[model samples]
Target chain A: MTDNSAHGLEAREDEWLAVRCQLGERAAFDELVARWHEPLWRYVRRVTAEDEAAREVLQDVWVRVIRGIVRLREGSKLRPWLFGIARRALMDRLRERYATPAAVPLQDFDLAADQDTSALEEDLASMQQGLEELPVTEREVLTLFYLRELSLAEVAEVLGVPAGTVKSRLFRARQMLRRDMDTKGRPV
Target chain B: MNQTNPAHPGGSPTLPDVQRLLDAELSLRSRLGYVALLLGSLGMAALAGALWLTEPALPFRTQVAFALMIVIGLSWTVFSVWVLRHRRVLYARQHIVAGRMAVAFTSVFVVSALAIGYGSGKDGAYAAAALGGVMLIGAVLMLLRGHRAFNRLAERRDGLARELGRST
Candidate 1:
C-alpha cells in the first residue's frame, strides 16, 4: 500500500479507538492503554531522563487524555492530540521543577542554517547516549523525529509549530547530538 | 535499548498500574453521583426560590432563611456541574444516562408540585410546579440532544470499523 493509504488506515483505526472511548467503552480504554503506553512511556522517559519523573508524567498524561478525549472533535488526529497533551504535561512538570514560567523557548533557529550536515548523515542509533546531554528543545525534536515515533506533520502538530520550524529544530538537534558525542570522545 | 532501569526495581508503571491509576477518574459511580447531585441541587434551588417569591406575608427572618437555602443549593449545583464537566466527565453513554435521569427526576418533580399546588391551594406550590415544568422541558431537550450526538458518533464509528475490516 502507498504511504498515504497506510496513513489513512492508521488514522481510521485511531479514530475508531477514540470513538469507542468517547462512547465510554471500558474495553476500549484498556486497549488504548495497552497500545500507546509503551510509546508514551519512552517519549516521557527520554525527555525527563528520570524513571520516577516519567512514571508520574505518564500517569498525568493519561489522566488528561481520559478527561479531555470527549472534547477532541477530530478523532483522526488522536496521535497528535495525545502527544500534544503529553507535551503540555511535560512542560508543566518541568516548569514546576525549575520554578520558571517558560520551560523551553520555542524560537526558530537561525544558527541551524549554519550547522554542518556531514556528521548528521551517520546513523542516529549510535548517538543514543548523547541525546541526554542536549538541550530540551533539540532533544525533543530529535526524539520525536529520529525515534520514528511521529511523522513530520504530526510532530509539528504536537509541538504546535510550523513544519519548517520542526525541520530546523531537527537539523539543530542532529548537529548538537554530533557535537556532544565528539566532545565526549565517542565515535559519531 | 532496554527501557527498564535496574536501579529502580519497579522501573515504570505497568499497564495494569496505569489502568488502576485511571480507575477513579473513569468511575461510573462518581460520574453518576455528580449528575444526581446536579439535578437534586437544581431542584432544591428552584423550589426554594419559587416559594420565596410566591409567599407574600413571610417574616423578614424567614425571607433571609429562604435566601440562604437558595444560595446554598445553587452553590452545590455549580460545584457539581464543574466536577462533572472537568473532573469526572460524562462520556456519550454517560451523557445519555444522565439525560434520562434528568428527565425522570424533573417529571416526578413537576407531577408532585402540580398535585401539591392543586391540593393545598397555595400560590407557592403553583410557582414551584411552573419551575418544575420548565426543568422537565429542559431535561427532554437535553435527552434529545444526547441521543442525536450518540447516534452520530456511533454511525461514524461503525463506518470506520467497516472500512478497516473490523467488527463494530
Candidate 2:
C-alpha cells in the first residue's frame, strides 16, 4: 500500500479505538496510550523544553484525551487533536511556571539577507545548536512542521494560531537558524 | 537544559511506564460509571418510545403516553445539561454536529407545535411558548461557534494531509 493510504488506514484504526474507548473499553484505551505515548512525549518535550514540565503537561493531555475522546469524530484528525491539547496544556503550565502577568510575544530576530548554502547544509551538531538558538515559539513551529512532520495546519492547530501565522513563523525561524549558522562560522 | 536535545529530552518515561500510568488511572470504576450513564440514558429513551407506540385501545392510555414522554424528556434534559457542563473541551466536530442536530430538532419541533396550536385555534399562548423555545435554540447555536473554528482548523489539516501524500 502507498504511504498515504497506510496512514489513512492507521487513522481509521485510531478512530475505531476511540469509539471503543468511549464505550468504556479498557483495552482499546490501552492501545491508544501505547501507540501515542512516545510520539506525544517527544512532541511535548520539544515544545516545553523541559522534561519535568513535559511530563506534567502530558499527564494533563491524557486526562483531557479521556474526557474528550467521545467527542472526536474523525480518526484522521486524532494526531492533530492530541497535539493541540498538549500545546494548550503546555501553555498553561508555562504560564503557571513563570507567573508572568503578560503573555510573552514570539520574538523576531534580525534576518541576515545573504545566502549561506554551505551553512544551510550543516552537521547534525550545528543544526541542533541552531535550533536551540531560536525563540520558543519559533522552535515549536519549526519542530512541529519539520521534525515532527506535522502539516502546516496541524502545527497551526496545535499552536492555536492561524495557518498564515504559522507560515510566517516558519519562514522567520529558518532565517534565524541560517543567521545562527553564519555566526558560528561553519567552514564553507 | 540548553545542552540537551529537546527532541528526546532526558528522564522521560519509556513506553512501558506510560502504559502502566494509563492502567492505574483509568480504573474500573470510572469506566463502569461511563457505561452505566450511557446505557441508562438509552434504556430510558427506548422505554419511552415503546410506551408511545402502544395501541390506544383503552381510556387513559393517551395520558400514560403523555406522562411517560414528559418524564423521559425531563430525564434526558437533565442528563444532557449535566454532560454539557462537565465537558471540558467543546471544540470537537462531533460535539458541534450534536449541537447542530439539537438546534435543528428544536426548530422543527417548535414550528410544528406552533402550526398545530394555531391551526387548531388554541390562541396566542402557543406562539408565546414557541418564542420561549426559540430562546433555548439561540443558546444552543451560540455554543456552537466553537464548531466553526474547528472547521477552519480542519481545512488546514486536510491541506497538510494532501502535502504529506505529495511528499511521500
Candidate 3:
C-alpha cells in the first residue's frame, strides 16, 4: 500500500509543475494533465456519467489549461482550482442539456447493492450509458469524494467554497442520491 | 459516493475502459520495445564479436564497459517483459515512480554518453545517438506529467488501503 505522507509530496510537485505550466511550458501542462487526468476523468465521469461527455470535459479542461494556466501560477491553488475550472466546463454543458435527467438510470441503480468500490472494474460497456443518467449534483459530489477521492476540504477547494459547506452539500447530495436510488428500487 | 446500493466500487465502467485502453497501448508500446530490445542485443553481440576478431587484445576497461551495457540492456528487456504480464499488479503511481526514475536515469546516462562521445561518428552512430536522446527527453516529460495523476491515485488508494486494513 502507498503511504499517505509520501503522497503529499506529489501534490507539492504538482503545485510546482503548475508554476512551470503557467510560464508557457506545454510540457509542464501536459504533465499536469497527465498527472490529474485519471482522477479528473473519474470525477467528471461521476458527475456526467457519459464517457464521451467526460472525455469532452477533460479535453476542454486541457484547452483551458493551455489558455488559462498562465493565470494560475499561485502554486497552492492548482488542484482544486483546476477542478473548479472542470466543474464550470461541466456545468456549462449541463446547462445546455438541462432537460431534467433521470435521477438514476435504472441499470445503475440496479447495480448489485452490496458491491463495493472494487466493483467498478467488473464491466465497462455495460455501465457506460447508465452512468450518464445520474443527477448532475450527485455525480459531482460522488466523483469528488469517492472516485477522485478528494477530501471534503479539497472538494470545497474545487468548488470554491468552504469545507463545511462541502460536508453539508455532500450529505445532502448523498441523501438525495440514496432517495433517488431507492425510488428506482435499489437497496441503497 | 453514489447511492449504488453501497456496493461494488471496483466494478465501475470507467476503470474497465481505462484498463482496456492502457492495456492495448502497453501492448503496442512493448512490441516495438521488444523489437528494439532484440535489435539492441543483436547489435551488442555483433560488436562483441567484432571486438573479438579485430581488437582481440582489447583492454579490461573497454571489455568491462561493453559487458555492463549488454547486461543492463538485457536485464531491462526482461523487466519490461515482466511488466507486460502483470500490468494489473502495478498501480498508476507505481508506474509513475519507476517510469520517472527511468527517465531521470536515462537522461543522466545520455548526457554522460554525449560527454564521452558515445559512437560519435561511425555509421548508424548518429541515428542511434539521436534516438537515445529523444527517448531520454520523452521519458523525462512523461515522468513529470505522470507524477500528478499518481498523486491523486495514491491518495485514493491510501484511503482504500486504510479501509481494507480496518476491515481485515
Q: Pick the candidate with the highest DockQ.
A: 1
Q: Candidate 3 on A53-101: residue-level lDDT in tens?
A: 7666766665555446545545556777778888989877777787664
Put down candidate 1 lDDT per residue, B67-134, tens digits, no spaces: 99899999999999999989999899999999999999999999999999899999999899999999
Candidate 3 docking band: incorrect
Better of 1 and 3 by DockQ: 1
Of the candidates numbered 2 and 3, which has the greater lDDT value? 2
**Fnat per predicted structure, each in turn:** 0.70, 0.18, 0.00
- Please report the TM-score between candidate 2 and the true structure: 0.53
Can you write out model 2's per-residue Cα lDDT over B31-68, one digit (the tens) per residue? 33443443345334433443344434435867676567
Task: Give the better candidate number (1 or 2) by TM-score.
Answer: 1
Q: What is the TM-score of chain A alone in each candidate?
A: 0.88, 0.76, 0.70
Interface RMSD of the predictions, in order shown?
Answer: 3.3, 8.5, 14.1
lDDT of each: 0.85, 0.61, 0.54
Model 3 gets an lDDT of: 0.54
